[model samples]
Target: MQLSPDEHIFWQYGFVKLNATIVFTWALMLVLAVGSKIITGKLATGLKRSRWQNLMEIVVVAMENQIAEVGLREPRRFLGFIGTLFLFVAIASLCTIIPGFKPPTGSLSTTVALALCVFVVVPLFGIEDQGLIGYFKSYLEPTVIMLPFNIIGEISRTLALSVRLFGNMMSGEMIIGILLTITPYIFPIVMTLLGLLTGMVQAYIFSVLATVYIAAAMGDQGLKQEPEAQQ
Candidate 1:
């Protein structure tokens, strides 16, 4: 059995090739884009609303509430970024039920890209909230000797994010594949349901961790300002 969606190549031109990961990822993005636009186009501000609109608003509000609970003061400011991350991962896993369809997240490249997005956004948001100097100054907190360690921690966490997602997704796919081979009927169906639950849980976890990181950045800035205010 193929270990990853990367193994399914659709096209090749010398050194360049298109694989299932790239194709499925783009397909997923397109669906999300078009679906969102369609759903939002007729958004009603009045008492009467479509069921789809209500459902969409519920999901969005729940996500925003979760972000606020995580310590982000203005959740809307971070909602777009964090919401997209959760939806992408959650949808990728949910779509696996389709026959012959594979989730791009089963590939290391996809997970790494997702993780790197988080890595980059962490500092960007921090800088936006704290100003460049103030954000960088966070590395010197408690002592300047912590600089290298802080830097290392950032890099290590990004790597961890990527590997954690990739391992969980790939292992799930592998387990399902093995079950299908050994007992082609009942067990695989049960496993598929469990996989869906696991996928959603993982999505929640990844999103929450990302929110924590962003909140920590802003929290550090708040802490730095507190002493000055007190003085």
Candidate 2:
């Protein structure tokens, strides 16, 4: 059985090569981009709304509420990043029902890329909320010796996020592949449904963790703003 989409090569030219991971990743992104355009192109303001518009509104509202619940003072500020992350992972899993389609998320590279996006954004959000000096100074909080540890914690968590997502997604694929070989057809079908549920759960967990990290990066400023928001 194929352990990773990276192993499936579709094209190669000396140092450059195209694999299943790259192909599917780009394909999925295109689908998301075009679908978003089509869904949002004719948005309705009146009482009469299309089902897709209603669904989109529901998802946006739900995501905003989730971000607020995670302690972000301005949910809309973080909605684009957080919502995109959730939708990508959730949609990738949902597409598994399609024949001959492999989720790019099952590959370590894709997960690492996703984690790196969060990694880079966290510091940016921090700097935006608390100027450059203030954000960097956060590492030296409470004492000077904690600086290295704080930096290490940031790097370590990014690694953990990537590995956790890759492992879970890959394992789900692995189990279904194994089941198809050793078990009957009906059993594998049941497992596939369970895997879809697990994928959605993983997407939620990943987005929540990212929001928590961003909220932490916002530091005391976020806390200070929270009360004002409540009032």
> Local error of candidate 2 at 172, Å?
0.4
**Best TM-score goes to which candidate?**
2
Pairs that clash in candidate 2:
none
Residue-level lDDT tens digits of model 2 in 100-145: 8899889998999999999999999999999899999989986899
Q: Identify the candidate with maximal lDDT.
A: 2
Candidate 1 yields a Cα-based lDDT of: 0.86
User: What tens-digit string does per-residue lDDT give for candidate 1 at 39-158?
Assistant: 999999999999989989999999999887777778898999999999999999999898887988889989999999999999998888899998899889769999999999999988
TM-score of 2: 0.93
Which residue runs of candidate 2 sit more than 4 Å off their true CA positions? 223-231
